[model samples]
Target chain A: MAKTPIAFSLNGMERSMFVDPGQNLLDALRRGVGDLSPKYGCAQGTCGTCSVLVDGKLQLACITLAEAVAGSSVTTTAGLADGSELHPLQRSFMDNFAAQCGYCTPGMLMAAKALLDRNPSPQRQDVVEAISGNLCRCTGYEPIIDAILKAAAFMRTRGRP
Target chain B: MALHRGRGFACVNYPIGMNLGGDPSQALVHSTPDGKFMVTLSSIDLGQGMKSVTRQIAAETLGVPVSDVYVDTADSDTGPHCMGSFASRGTHRVGNAVIRAATEARTQMLQAAAEELEVDAADLETDGEGGIRVRGAPQRTISVADVAVAAQFKQGRTLSGRGIFLVPPSEVDPETGEMSPVTCFAHAAMAVEVEVDDETGMVRVIEINSAYEVGRALNPKLVEQQLVGGAWMGLSHALYETTEPYYPDRDHLPVDFNTYLMPGPGDVAPHNIAVLERPAEDAPFGGKGPGEMCANPVLPAVANAVFDAVGVRCDDLPITPEKILRGLRANGS
Candidate 1:
């Protein structure tokens, strides 16, 4: 199969690459764009470790084809921070000790970011529902939920997006 | 048409380190010209904060600030030997080795400082701030960096230490089949409450309360994470996870995470944890590792809860909905 020319905006930067037609968006981001934060957990979209935002919508990168979203905006955990300073969610997660083993952190952060983007002051149930797709083997889901709620309050005070 | 609630409890104990064939962990400690120390060990962190705990141990032993110590767990080939990070032995075994190495290195540093001050080594004490001072003489002090420079350049003494910890093999009585395998043991007790819907034969865990007696908590946060994560693994083993679809005959095995089921965020229940610190006599800093013990008691506790809920014993690994329904029909409940 011939490679197809695809272009997209990634982490606020426009990138173009020749990707295989059968290649998934995860491979395009990790191999083509040199973004390693989004991990390959199950690679079948069940673990949600490859979660990323395409056009401000949450989707699994493993199942989403690269050619399908030729011209779209993609956001990853690496983009969550502003240079050296960490984002509110990252700080809250660190302060609350939300990550253990850290394999599921990137996906959890992306899912939480999507939730807070839609509903700034979400209830506990709303937080649970939003992160239901992501699976974390550590922290027992308590601290992760607490971190998201705390980040929401922190973002509210900081007047952040 | 009724939902029955049941409660169950279990207590378990697990050994700390590997006992067979002599489990050994080695560490090398050396000081830089700038007074900063580095400890190189082959132990892998596995994201369990092994580096942080070992660094703290070395700093405490060397009478220096924690920030002054850096642990390099680079690789097994480059550093000293460790029996890998499993059996919850990383803290107990590697920490002892680090303490021993740091203590030896501290002795060398004090001796070098004594030579620089022209005082007896016995009268010199470390100030825990990279400084060595004479006893009862507050103003007479020499920086550790100055001592390191003199020890290497002037005295031709290397400011380094090597240590290895090995548990002696125990003699087993063949007739009695009794032997002390490990030095220390960690204990835990767990209680689980669950609701069973008779119509659908579905079980939902409402709450879990657990008490663990770790020999000591080197880092409290790390211990809590291990306990919570371990309990979740126990829950998975008791209810949700299974490798074989049909036991005794491998058919339609799960090849991916989709086919294999694990607990999601919604399945998590309220967990209350109590940590008890009973210092072990022989352990390094009285710490008996609590890594692998977290998942032990959860299995039996949840199994007993299912039996109590529907009055049916599930000896199988996963007490799935199909098993519970079959048990209910067999018991004619």
Candidate 2:
């Protein structure tokens, strides 16, 4: 298959890469740009492991065409943390042990970020509805919810509106 | 303690000629002969973090550092035979065997350390770093790693320990379908509430309360993860996971990320989750398996919850809107 030149900003860096016709954004990112945050849990997008932000909207990269997001900014999990410093959600996730095996963390984090970006002070119900699709087989939602709420508190104190 | 599988009495203590039903998990541990070390099961980590917990159990028993207690899956070619990890029985059955094996290893290390440090073997306490010493005597210490290197692998001493625990075949008459040796039992319970759309018949699990008897919580955090994971799986089974349309034509089935109908941020219950853990006596860590326990109740739970809200008892794995609507239509609701 002939490769198509797709331009996009991954994480924070503006970059362009040649992608195969059959390649999804996930494969293109993980295989091409060397970003390993968004994992391939269920390639069918149901598992939410390959979620990324395309133009600031959460999208499943595994099924998404690389061409769809041409010239769009893509944000992956790796870009969330500032070097060794974790984002509030990531910190809360670790503190609450919301992630285990961590295969699903990337997608879950992205989804939650999208939710918070939309409604930073979402109620518990809103939080549930926001992350309903991301399946985590390890921590029952109790901790994840707790972590999210805690992150919200921290984010508020830090003036992350 | 030998790690066994299934619901007691039928635990197979020996490995099979062929992989059983294509279970990808395995047990891992190294043991020595003289009934000193025991390798109970393979190191098949089910994302429960029991692998590290198994090492903890082994190290604590052997008086070695958690790191010194290296674990590996038994080789079908020439290793001790036992059922590999799966069915969430690692800590229950395998942890015991690992304890037994490590205890033997510990004893030898202690005896050697005692003799070298001029202290009673009982006077020494094992450390997580695989070292042992008298309570107040820092200088009087011996490392289990050094002992293992000198005593087993290097000296060619048979570091062989064996654990074979099979679920006892039910003593009940086979003709009557009764069986025994009922090695152990694990129980779980779940309570869920779902909101059903009267128009759409869509059932959304609104709240879930769950409790399980885990022989023990080897890794408290890890087990919690299992509970969360199980709940999600249950949720998936209740609403989205189905093997229908693309069944006969496997290729047509939901493939890749886009086509499948899976619960997402927009699909989960908003509030209420209660998780309780009950310890088990027979389990090596007093934790029972929580992995599948949460899932088993999910289908029935959501269905029952939906029924509570909309008055329907769905008799299907996934109580999809179609099934609920059908149940409603059959009942003329």
Candidate 3:
């Protein structure tokens, strides 16, 4: 199989890696770079577990080709927190119990965080629309909504840095 | 949501939706304005045990007798959701989490107290919120509040506790299409009453009532919430939910909630008060899942209810207008 050279910035680090032609960015991250936060759920581009922030925009890493992200920035769930201290949304997910069987968390967090980062104080419907692609069987989507709202409230309290 | 067709067939089933391998928060150890926030989370509260196990573990840890603790399973990262998604092991999984976290806090408090008093940690007793009076002394006392504060300096670390448990929870082999492939069963029984339209063939939902063996109710209100939520989800799977992905090989036809055909308030019948029966072997406070369980029987119950209402036994799911008409035709009515 022919290989393609790819270059991208991940979690604030600039790096270059050779990816197989059939490999998606998610595969490269999980297998090549050793980032396991993004899971292999449906691999059908349906479940949002493989979501990542591509150049500040939420995109499915499972579908994006590794070669397409050259010079682009990719952020995974592992990039969201500062060591053990979690992101506000991550912390609120703990507080509200938003996630269960957290396979969807990486994508959910990425999507919700992207929305929140773009619009710090999103309304309830906004939160709903934000995570429409992610599927969570645990919290019944209620606490997930509550956590986004709670995280918004927290961000507002913190002046939304 | 599984029905055994044959007699004497033992079944163990895991929930279909709950994928066990992921990280969510289960316990939070922090000092509140008036007290400490010590929480215990089940695998995933998912609107089921988010708040209940919090209460049970807090009550157990503080020795406040389960009344004083308040749980919120609002977040997922810091807590743990269960091994799978059945809404049946809410108590078992979260109860174990509650035990682990609360027990950790309990040990830390008693050990800290022992350190201060220069006695064996084994000799001390805990009363929930650091209400540690001397085992025999009438005057010697250590309030929960004080131990919590002192623990910050003594333990040299945040006293947060966490436990990750994959209970395997009723294994239903999706690959093989096998249900009840395990030894654990969080059984629930449901009943519903419906009204079917003969002319237009529209079966408007009338009312639904369900009962589940919840082992024990850590939070009774949460159990009701789970049942209500599960009932709605089950309704979709039975009557509206389709396992078949929409056209276009990858695009989920049910892309949005609107097309997903999930039940709204208008489409849903009033969740008649669901009765939660307590089982013995669940947890410290006897809690189990009610959300997913409540949904399992909804389709069948509605089908059964429709059969009762219109004298038709529909084998296929979703008892839609077409299915109802077919059911009517099959019944020769």
Candidate 4:
């Protein structure tokens, strides 16, 4: 198949890649642009492991076309850190032991970031609803929920990172 | 006609390690020239913290700080032999192997320190802070790093050790058909509360409380993770998950995470866990594996809860709504 060129702002860096026709954003990011944070959990848009923020909105990269977000800015878990400093969510995840196998961490963290970006002081129910689309088999969802809430509290007090 | 809440309890005693013929695990402990230790093993950690637990075991046996030891479970082909990580044997079997290997390495480290300190090997003790010293006189001490350098460059000695742990298979008498399968057992008791809707035949697990005797938790946090997540899995098995929903027909099998049903985050209940440690004599550091048995009690507890709520005996797995409704109709309630 002939490849189509697309350009986008990924994690605050300008990246351009030649992608096959109808390639999903996940493949383009992982293969073409080399951002491996967005994982491929379910390509059918069920598990949210491929979730990324496109133009500051939560979108499933596995279902989204790479061409659709040509000029838009995308963010993934790989971009969550600032050089050596970790995002508040990452610290909270570590402190709370939110991840076990960590296969679902990227998407789960993206979902939580989207939630915190919108509502900085979400209730426990909101936290549950935010990560409802993502599936984590190891932590029983409690520690992840606790981590998200803790990050929200920290972000609210110290300003979002 | 309405929602009824009921509570049910169940208990279990689960065996440790595989019952097959001679389940074995091996480890190789070696020291770097700078005194850091690396433990090599073929065991795999499938999110059960095998690497972390074994590292702690190695450090403990070597009388070194935990940070000085690193467990490298690089690959099965490159490392020592292991029976793999099923039957919750990774911690128990692999941990014992690590203890043995680290003990041997510790002996070598002490001998090297003794050579430098001009003291007997038996009189030299690890300070547990990266230093080796005379047992009674702490002032006469040598850093483990210096000892490693001397042992390698001065003495031309290699500081390494290998160990393997095996549980010999038990033989069954042909006539009586009895045998000892495992060395020790982990015990647990759980009580589950559920709400059963008589109209929709729906069951919702509300709360769970359990006590586990895990034979000395090597890592309490890891044990808690296992117990909490294991209970969720048990809840999933009791009500939500099924690869083949319609049995005997072999149709509409779930192919992906969407169709393959599991309890979502919203479906979770408050779970309270109490861990009891009795310290098994034969266990590594008197610790048993907490991987497999934490979910066993939930299956029967949920079944008993359903029966208590709606007076239906859901003996089959997944305790689906259709089965509960059928049982209710047959009861003429």
- Fnat of each candidate: 0.57, 0.63, 0.06, 0.57
Best by lDDT: 4
Q: Please, what is the TM-score per model? A: 0.93, 0.72, 0.57, 0.97
lDDT of candidate 3 over B213-278, digit per residue (tens): 656655665565566666667766766765444323556555544455554323546656546465
| Model 4: how far residue B136 lies from native, Å | 2.4
Docking level of model 1: medium
Query: How many clashing pairs does model 3 include?
Result: 48
Task: Write one digit per residue (lDDT tens) for candidate 4, span B164-272.
Answer: 9988788988999998888888999999999999999999999999999999899998899889988988989999888888887779888898788899999999999
**Ten contiguous residues minimizing lDDT sum, candidate 3 chain B:** B2-11
Q: Is model 2 an incorrect, acceptable, medium or high docking prediction? A: acceptable
Off by over 4 Å in 3: A82-84, A118-123, A153-158, B1-124, B128-133, B138-215, B219-229, B240-292, B304-315, B325-333
Writing each residue's lDDT as its tens digit, candidate 2 over A1-161 gives 78899888988899899988878989988898899888987787688889999988999999999878789999999999888988999999988877766777887788889988888787987778777768775655567777888898889889874
Ten contiguous residues minimizing lDDT sum, candidate 2 chain B: B3-12
Which lDDT tens digits does candidate 3 get at residues A42-111? 6768778899999999988888888889899989998999888889989998776565556777788898
Off by more than 4 A, model 1: B115-118, B129-132, B142-157
Candidates ranked by DockQ:
4, 1, 2, 3
Fill in the DockQ of model 4: 0.74
Please tell me how candidate 4 rates in CAPRI terms. Answer: medium
DockQ of each: 0.63, 0.40, 0.06, 0.74
Give me the displacement of residue A26 in model 1, in angstroms: 2.0
For model 1, how does the per-residue alpha-carbon lDDT over A12-79 read when each residue is reduced to its tens digit?
Answer: 99999999979999998999999998999888888898999999999999999998778999999999
